[model samples]
Each structure stands twice: as C-alpha cells, then as structure tokens.
Target chain A: MLVEKSAAELSELLSGGEVSAVEIAREYLDRIESINPSINAYITVDGERALEEAAESDGRRAKGEALSAFDGVPVAIKDNICTKGLRTTCGSLALGDFVPSYDATAYRKLREQGFVTLGKTNMDEFAMGSTTETSHFGVTRNPHNTDRVPGGSSGGSAAAVSALLAPLALGSDTGGSIRQPASFCGVVGIKPTYGRVSRFGLVSFASSLDQIGVFGRSVDDTALMLGAISGGDSADSTSIERPVDFAPGGLDGEVRGMVIGLPGEYFHGVAPCVKDAVMKVAGELEKRGAKIEPISLKYTEYAIPIFYLIATAEASSNLARYDGIAYGYRPSGAESLSELYLRARSESFGKEVKRRIILGTYALSSGYYDAYYLKALKGRTLVIDDFNKAFDKVDCILSPVATGTAFAIGEKVNDPLAMYISDLLTISANLAAIPGMSVPIGLDEAGLPIGLQIMAGHFEEKKILNCAKAIESFVEPLRPPL
Target chain B: MSTMDEKQILRVARLARLDLSEQEMSEYARQLNDILAYVRKIEEMETANVRPTDHIVDLHNVFREDRVQSSPGAEALRAIAPRFEDGHVVVPIIIEGQE
Candidate 1:
C-alpha cells in the first residue's frame, strides 16, 4: 500500500516515477473512506480538493518546478490548525462551521511545497483533553486496539498515520498532546523548541506552551517536515529570528561517545512494561557506544501542577475571544450582550473546556492569584533550572513517554486527576521550552505500542533527532495490527 | 487549598462569561476543588526569591518597517463572519437601551 510507506519512501517513489502525485492522493483518500469509520481519525475528507492539489503537484514536477523532497506527498493536519476554505473545527461544535480565511503557517508552508492535505483530523475540544474522548466529533480509537483511546488532543493525527490513512500528519502540543498520542499509536512525533515554528494560524490553546509539530513513521521524515515548516515568520512576532536548517542527513547511524541521560525522577512509578521498554532501547544504544547515565531532575514531581496552573491561565485568556460575535456559532434570542456571550460559550464549549475556563478565571481572580498562579510561575523557573542543570551532564534525556500504553476509552475520562497524571512524563520538556520527541521502541505485553521520549536542551533538536535515529535503528519498530 | 462551593463556581463562571446550570455549577464546584487540592502542593515549595518566568524564550521588541502593506480585503474578512451587514459585522447591542 502506498499509504503504508514512509514519507521518505513515498518521496522517493514520486521522484523515481514509480507513482504519480494524483495516485498517491487518491490512495490515501480511498483509505480514509474505508478505514475512517472504524477509528474516526478524520472529521473531514477533502477528496476533490486534494486531487486538485495533487494535479498541480504533478504539473510542477513535470515542469521541473518541484519545490522540495516532500513535494506531492500526502499529509494530515489536526483540526486546531486552520485551513482556508476548509471547516476546521477544533473537535468542538463552537467551530463546526468556522472556516478560516487563511491557513496556519505550518500547513501553508507544506502546501507551498506541494504537499497534499488529506484532511483536518479530529482532536479534543480546543486541544484540552489527554484522551480523545472529549472530542465533540467522537473519540478517536487507537488502531492498535479498537476499545482503547489514541491519546490526544492530537489523537486523530496519530491514529491516521498509525492506520495508514496518511504517511505523515501535523499536530499541536500544548501539554503532551502530540507525544502522548504518538506514543499510544507508535509513531515518531517531534515537538520542536518553543519559537522554532510560527504560531500564526494555530488556534491558541495555551500560547506559551502550544507548538505545532510533525508525526511521521520515522525520524528522518519528521526531520524533513520540521525543516520545511520551521524558521521565523513576519506574522508571528514570537517566532525566533534564526536560520532553519534541519540537516536531515545528520541522522547518521553513529552514536559513539554521545551522552544519553535517564532522569531518576521519571522512572519512578512508571508501569514496569513501559520502564523496561525504555531500558531495552537504552541498553541497545549502550552497545552502540553511547554512554547512559542516571541524572536528577528533582522538580519533576511539581511539573504537573505547574503546567496546569500556567496552561489553564493562558487558556482562559486566549479562549475569551471565542464569544460568537466574530466567526463562531452564536445562539439566538439573547436579551442582553452578557447573556449572549454567556449562552454562546456555555452552550458551545465542552465539559473539559468549561472546567478549564472556570479554573483559569479563579486562578487569575483577585486574592488567589498570588497563591496559585504566581507560585506556579516561580516553580516553572525551578523546572527550567533543573533541565539546564541536567543538560550540562548529558546531550539528551530519555524516558517513557507515558505511564502505560493506550488505555480503554472511558477508563480515565471520568477521572480527571488520573488523566492529568498521564501527561506527567511528557510535560516537563514543554514547561522547560526544550525540544522533545517520541519514537516507537517496542510493544508491550498486550501487543500495545510503547514509546521512548528523547529530549534535548533548548534549540538542540539536531542532537535529539540523532539520538532518536540511532534508537530507531537499534529497536525493531512495532506496527499496529490494523 | 480552599474548597470551592457552588457560589464560588458561579462567580468564576460569571467572570468567564459562561452560563452554567445549577447541576453543572455543583458538579464543577466539586471537580475544581479536587483539582485545586492537587495544585496547592506547589505553595509548599520555597520560591520566595525566584523571579516568575512568563516566557521561556528570550524576547526582544521585534519591529517591522512602518510602511503601508495591503491585507486581505474587507470582503474576505466579512465572509468569515456569521452575520455581516452593510460592510460591517452585525452584532447585538453592547449597551442597554442604546439604539
């Protein structure tokens, strides 16, 4: 199946004349039609539009005008990222009809390189949940097991790639939204260092924490995509002014003398299978001449609380713009302006979103701000210091991506605290504003996928990608039995 | 950590511009209390002298040339609005008893 091939392999086929761009686009669209009903990974399938774009890609290739290596390749995008003329609901009814007039910079960059967008995939409402169950469209079931969830709010992107619906996809990570799902689905996901990518058309979940990233079947493919979408954008002032060079060829199979650190705090209380899976990957790298050492990130225990406080506060401020006065759904028969705003938000936002909004309002309210919000901000500094201290001893950090494999869909949906803890291992990287990724290492006892997280210091993406590539070469990649 | 009650939940919901039913207010009050109980552990840490880190990236004032540039036309902008009238967005009254 063309859809089963890695993005690099697909690029090779397109360039080698083994397949046409239109054929590749049609193959993925057809797969989405047949398989999407089971997993519900995608909310919209723009078959006609995709084919039209594919035809343009073919014309470009024939005229010797191909843009990049990923020209004519098909990719999926999370719904939170806007697309022109496409209904990009962020898995919520509030945006069920909100089509943007512009495209997200990440997707626009890929589109300029002639990448065919498969469709906008499903996600948690406003990218707020750990499990895809909160999605207004439906829960995106894990391809590995139908009864289990694909961790979210990038669950649909992860499941789409896992089920061979698309070779590559784009996802947004606020608090492990990207890596957790990628781990559950056994795909390679990269959340670049903050400011590495522009946030122009991405709907803000938590502005300080949210970053757009890529999910591919291999590190090489992810690196290629990152190179294409990275760099400064004039529209986004927060985007760093720097050269965007991924040097995809640098993912050589040599890890000799590379230092990998395993944080002692991350290993505590992780499921035995998940811990063992990471250890096995570490042992393989050790044989490849990479030194593995145990280090301390003592503030690891406070990461979850810090993340929740800061993230929810930012979410409250960012989400205040969705008052149905501009672009989203607005209810009728409001006697007053306040009533209209209240009804629109209360009616449209899902349970989790409302909960976060209320929490955020309380955190920022008078008298409580010092104890909750300010304290968390100071703790965030300590968290960053911990990472800085550890990076002095090692090139990258390795740990389990999640506590365990994909859980049954409703197991933790009703239990909010347990669901929040699921992001315990992955949020530290985000809070520290460093680059972190999940690469599939092996499967657990129940035939579910386990992922090892590779994290590096700020703007040290190349180092982590190299480490992930080495681990990929050493471990047998697990394919979901779809 | 302070326990949240229905009145507190309503206050926050009103501040957030969300209209919650009595049932939902009570439910949210319960959940928010539980979540805050967990989050209060950070207060125990001695962060007295540490400065708050708002953004992780070192930021400078980014400026662009103050030259006029064309943007997507108002027609395109109005097309995204749910209710557009006479070249402007139609909205409900902002102030009571104002025409």
Candidate 2:
C-alpha cells in the first residue's frame, strides 16, 4: 500500500490538509517500529525530534507559511554523514561514540530546506564494503529477502527507503556503494557526478571517487530530493560550483535525439538474466524514440583492478587520521603507543577495513608504488578516456548496475575477491568521475531486484536524468515486499 | 610476481600500525599474496603511453580565500580524547621523551 505514495505525493497530502505532518511522521515511525526490527535498516531513529519538527511544520502550514516542497518530509541520512549532536558512526566501532560538533554541509542544506530528519542509517564500517555485512553493527537484511544482504555501505539507506521506513535517504557511493544497494533493495539511487554534492560531512572513504547520493522510490522523487541537496558548498573543497536543475518536468519521457550507448565490455561477464533485463530496458528506450548504439569502452575490463589500487591508496591515507589520539574508540590496557594504535584499530575495525588498509599500504609502499599504485592511476586515466570517447559518440551509457542480482548474506563475504567483483559495472563511473544511477527495472526469478545503470558525462546530470526518467516511465515502479 | 614474506608482512603491518600476531601474519601473507596475484593481471595490458589520472575531473588548484575561519575549538578536540591532561590528548608513551 505504501508503494502508491511518492515523497512528492506524501508532501502534497500533508500540504493540502488531507493529512498533517505529525500524522505522516507517526505512520512512518509506526512502520519502522513494525518492520525495522527485522531488516535492521535504521541504526538510530529520532522519533521525539522528528515529531517535534513535524508539529512545527504543521504550525507553519496552518499560518499559510509554506516551506520548500520537501518541507516536513521525513528523511533518513547515512551514518557516515555528520549530523551535529548525533552519533555519526560510519558503522564502525571506532566512531560508535563519536558525536559530530558541526553538521555536514549536506545535512545543513537539507535542514535549512525544512526537511525533518528521521535519523542516521547503517553502512559498511568506514564505507569500505560492497555489502552491508561488513558493518560493525550487524548486517542490514534485504527487504525483499531476509537471507540476502541489502547491497552495501549505503545498504541501510536503500533498505530503509525500500521498506518504506523513510520516503527518501542519503547514501555515499565511492564505488557502487549506493547503486549496488539500490539494485539489491529494488529502489532508485543516484550517485551524482562527483563534486555535484558537498562531501563536507561524509566520512572520507576515497576522496576523489566518493559522492553523496540519494535513494527514493521513484525517479521524480529522487530528482526532487537530489535537486534540494545538489548545489555546491564552499565547506567542501571538492564540491562543484556549477548550476543544477533537478526539476521533475524532465520526467515526461521524451528522449528524442539522445544517444544511449551500450558498451560491449560491460555486458561481457554479466549474468544472463541480468543482461536480459538490462538489454530489455535498452530496447525499451530505443522504442521510445531514443537511439541505442553499441559503443566500445576498451579499458572497461581494467576498471576493478584500477579501482582497488586508487581507492585503497586514498583510503589508506584518509583513514590514517583515525588514530586513538583524536575521536573514535581507544582501547584500554595499552602499554605502548604502538600497542595503543594496534589495539584500538584491531578491535575497532572490521575484517574488510583491515584488508583494504593492508592492500593500500602495500600498494603505496615505496618499492611497489610505481608498479601498482602509479600504474593503476594510469589505468584510471585510460578508463576515463574510454568514457570520454563513448560520450563523444553517445550522451549516456546504459548497463546493469551489477553483474548479477543480490546474493545471500554470507554468499560472497568469505570470498573477498568475488565480493570485490560485485562492483564491476559500477566502478568505472567512479573511476571516470561521472554521474551514474541505478534504476530498478525488474525482478529475477528468485524475485530479487535487478537495476539498469545509466551513466553520463561529468556535470551532464540533466542528460542522464532525462534518459533515466524515460526508461523509468516505461517500466513502472516496483512494489515493495510486505 | 613479488612474493610477500613474513618479514615483509611485519614491515607492512608495522608501517600500517597493525600489530598482527604470528598466526595472523602467516594468514595475512597468504591472503595478501592471493590478492596481489589478482592485481598482477593488469601488468599484461598494454598501457605503454597512457597518462595517469590522479582525479577524474580536471579541477586544479581549487583554493579557497586565505582567511581565518572558525573551527571547533580545543574544547571539541578535548571532547574527542579518551584522556586529556594539560590541554593535550594523553596516549601511551612509545618514544621516550617525546611527550
């Protein structure tokens, strides 16, 4: 029943006096109270604060003072984003008790727009894993199937939105963190062009690749939320200063003259069912007056190896700041400085975190830097070049977000290599620093969701959104599992 | 292929500030070698004349105005510390006379 209402629909209902903000918040809170215990989607819920904000929003509306369209709309934020006075744990025990003193630029912008904060959602520890299973706080289960993991890092945000606990949620994607989870949970998630949204509040996973994205039930709703949160902020050095137009007017399903590319390499290793669903979407777009062409991104095969080296190198450098000296948990009974760091990190970080740190340190180590780190950086350039070439021929690239549907919770966790490959189709976008989104297309035989990823050139989010909206209109929004 | 040895694992662990037990060191060496072997596949690709990309976007020198800005003061910094004394976070002494 909740599948019928979009964020805009719910907002209109609240504004038109059909329902009050307090009642809306209560309904979602009630839903969370009923469903969250099973999915583990939300790590923290601010019921009291949310209701207080709702009451205030209701008062404003009563006096004929209207806020933004999203005003009084309930939303969830990923735990990695800093919210002043809230526990902004990146789902790691290290930052479990760390409370941010200042709001991340994105949080401030959302709050200023009058959106009610529901609470922080869970994620992979330090936003390091492809599956939410790496979260220090237990794994977030998929709303579709309890046995499978909601895809990760932003898995909690996607699952929460999918389960209707929140109308919209924020997630950060460094390498498929947002899109992969969106695919798994059967929702729409967009990883904006890097620098499109400010990264001030998001804990750094891989600086160049990390971008704050949003999860919503529909493309238009996702666009509305993205529009509100997208502009540049000086607080984050990497935030873009370009103008952004996220109006839902473009959702009219018109893609005339738009060239959508099907990269031959992206489809090479994909599962048959997944490839069938994605190609069906491409075929649908072609039917809607869009030109679909086969394009070659020759360097596509090198995406995963290049991604790990660069991301791990950046992660190693960025995570070095989490020493026990500053905030984050510090282990007791340390006899020496070395022991202090060793114990704190060992106890605080999960296996994936340690694995990445080791890999990064080794890559960036003096002797191997040229062979591994530097070469990977060059390979990254080739990947970007490949995208640039494709864009010259087409406005956007369409592919499956992942090679396959969501796997069971423990399916790939023990096999790190297999888990790493889960990000195959998505890593190139991050590597090339372009905008990419995962829009749910159809469910597999097991009833698991499969997402069709659409990517665009840097700062060309409008074009990507146009193409995505065109596809989304054809394949109706998926209904959530009860 | 560059094979990782115990000494190399200890050296890397030390640089990474990870104090791995003897058992963990051997285990990590095995896992790390497997991972590196996978990464080694990139060596076969011909990237002879490719340029290295440090960042995806061509942004350079994104400098802000040089002016003093307000940040969370020492109080906030102190709040983060597990223990503090004399306006400093207290940590175990590893290097003698450093504190």
Measured against the true two-chain complex, the DockQ scores of the candidates, in the order shown, are 0.78, 0.66
The 10-residue segment with the lowest total lDDT in model 2 chain A: A1-10
Fraction of native Cα contacts reproduced by each candidate? 0.79, 0.66
Instruction: Name the candidate that leads on lDDT.
Output: 1
Question: Candidate 2 lDDT, tens digit per residue, A224-265?
Answer: 888888877778767887776657875665788788999898
- The candidates score, on chain A by TM-score, as follows 0.99, 0.98
How far does residue B68 in candidate 2 sit from its true spot (Å)? 3.1
RMSD of each: 1.2, 1.8
Model 2 pairs in collision = none
> Deviation in angstroms for A413 in model 2?
0.5
TM-score: model 1 vs. ground truth: 0.98
Which lDDT tens digits does candidate 1 get at residues B9-96?
8888889999988777778777788898999889778898999997789887888778888897878868788788888888888877
